[model samples]
Target: MPSFHNGAVEIAYLDEGEGDPIVLVHGFASSKNVNWVYPAWVSELKKDGRRVIALDNRGHGDSVKLYDASQYDIAMMANDVLALLDHLDLERADVMGYSLGSRMTAVLALSQPRRLRSAILGGIGIGMIEGGGPGENVAAALEAPSLEAVTDPVGRTFRAFADQTRSDRRALAACLRGSRRLMTADEAAGIAVPVLIAVGTADEIAGSAQALGKIIPGSEVLDIPHRDHMRAVGDKVYKAGVLDFLSRQD
Candidate 1:
């Protein structure tokens, strides 16, 4: 149970492996274990001699949850990551994020691109380019009882997610507020670090991962065919693509 008091929250992170640091940021209603832990990706990277650090963002996993919606903003989340880096005394590291985590990494690139060795944005879409997302509506959906009704259930994806967050609705709702922070194309283009925008061809959530990648300097988009957002992260092709992206320096 490793933790860092990131000024605003105690970010619980899994620090494993050995070599250049690579931070893993998980998406909404997901923990480090759910997103990256079970995938065997961490061990694969460690075997490759790369350091892996997967964090539990505030309001998710073992970290503290703030009742305030403002705390769940992307800026705060990004700051918490920066604080974790500061706590570890690591000046620079590679970053990879998915869904809500991807948005957080986007804000980090915009605010402090120099601190990143490289970046991987997964399951990103054009719908979130405006730096804001649906608010109370998403929050309410998070709070609603699944046994009663679902305004627009996305089939098993919705049910699976509900089960995943069944124990902690508030944290999930807080993460839902984070959807409000989106980055425009021009904003993404400003990032000079090596980047990879990756998504599955069947990922309905990532409406435009390719479009998101094209704008960044020296960034590449890798499409994993026949996979959806939930399944993309575990594919060998996806892992290889991400590894190639991060390993290429200068």
Candidate 2:
């Protein structure tokens, strides 16, 4: 895993193939391999002659772990993406993210749209963008003494997944604490780049893709029928939608 320094923190990333660049950001507790490679996103994009660049956000995967809660701010993590682009000498590139990654993408779109040609926000919904999420619960769950100590269902599920992945639980708790920031309606309306908001029909965490689309002017929604949050990442509908969207950008 290739890595770079953003100040003192090291961010792990993978760059592959060639052509236009697409920087991929994975969801919380997921690494580049699990979110991008296992889903075959790299292969699919490569087939389309795209250069796939994906990074494990700080505190996840092979990136430097931070125990400080403030180190996990969404904006801080988003800047890591920008730093990677700088390291690679990319002036700008299409950016794609899922779940927590989607929120970070929105931060970039709001604070650093100059660094993006387009934005793809997956497994995210209007609710998360507006002001609601399981951040507090999830954070507490990550730090709980045991799985039995995690009472929230959402928190419990995430805790189990983190355990399964053998992730740094303390670091994840800090990430959740620092990354609960929300994007206001004004911020969403102000995004100037082409945007795609995608989610599965059965994804409870993602409030409504259609609702989110209505907020971003000219944005499009890709609905994967019958797929849930965990099942939507690698769905054929999602891959096709992304490919079609990228194709039209040329």
Candidate 3:
């Protein structure tokens, strides 16, 4: 694991394989290893001959933890990705993100389109515009004394995940509270780069993949049949679609 300073925050990341670069960003309460590596994403992508880079967002995994809710704004988190690209001297590369990371990917695609060859948004759909995910209830769940104290279904799921990961619950609470901004339809429509939006057919967390696709001009959508938000991460269909999407770019 290597790290670099994005201002005061230390971001831990893994850079593996060789060839054209593709950065991976994990979801909320999840780290690079859990979200990408354990799911065989790095291995599969490497097998496809890509330079894979994944990072621990600030306040998650091995990255510097911050307790201030104001520090976890979506743009701030997105900037970390930009900083990572700058650190690696990559002027532009394919970028992929899951769940919360999807939001960051969209921000980069919209605000800094020139920095991305393409964008892959997994575990996210119209929620990018309609706005839904871990809300204050999830934040409250993170602040709860224990998972048993979290009764909200969604909250409990995230709390249990945080416990399983042995993450900084307090820091996650702030991140959940701060990184709740949603993009407007105009913003989503503004994205000009090649975009691939993949969501499970059974995913309740991500809205409609087709709906989002319709919003982003020329964007492609891939549906992971019968998979939900969590299970969709490593689905074969999702992997194949991504590889195909990447291949088309070359």
Which prediction has the highest TM-score against the true structure?
A: 3
lDDT of 1 by residue, 79-129 (tens): 888887888888999889987888888788778888898878887766447
| Cα TM-score of candidate 1 | 0.91
Please list the residue runs of candidate 3 whose C-alpha ends up more than 4 Å from where it truly belongs after superposition.
none
What TM-score, computed on C-alpha atoms, does each candidate reach? 0.91, 0.97, 0.99
User: Candidates' lDDT values, in order?
Assistant: 0.77, 0.91, 0.95
| Order of quality (TM-score) | 3, 2, 1
What C-alpha lDDT, on a 0 to 100 scale, does residue 34 get in candidate 2?
A: 87
Shift of residue 21 alpha carbon in model 3, Å: 0.4
lDDT of 3 by residue, 8-74 (tens): 9999999999998999999999999999999999999999999999999999999999999999999
Candidate 2 lDDT over 104-191, as tens digits, reads: 9988987887889999999998966665656788888988999999889999988998998889999998888888888888889999
Judging by lDDT against the true structure, name the best candidate: 3
Q: After superposition, how far is residue 159 of candidate 2 from its true place, in Å?
A: 0.7
Q: Name the 10 consecutive residues with the lowest summed lDDT in model 3.
A: 128-137
Give candidate 1's whole-model lDDT. Answer: 0.77
- Point out the worst 10-residue segment of candidate 1 by lDDT: 126-135
Question: Model 1: runs farther than 4 Å from truth?
Answer: 130-138, 165-167
Residue 98 lDDT in candidate 2: 95
- Candidate 1 vs candidate 3, TM-score winner: 3
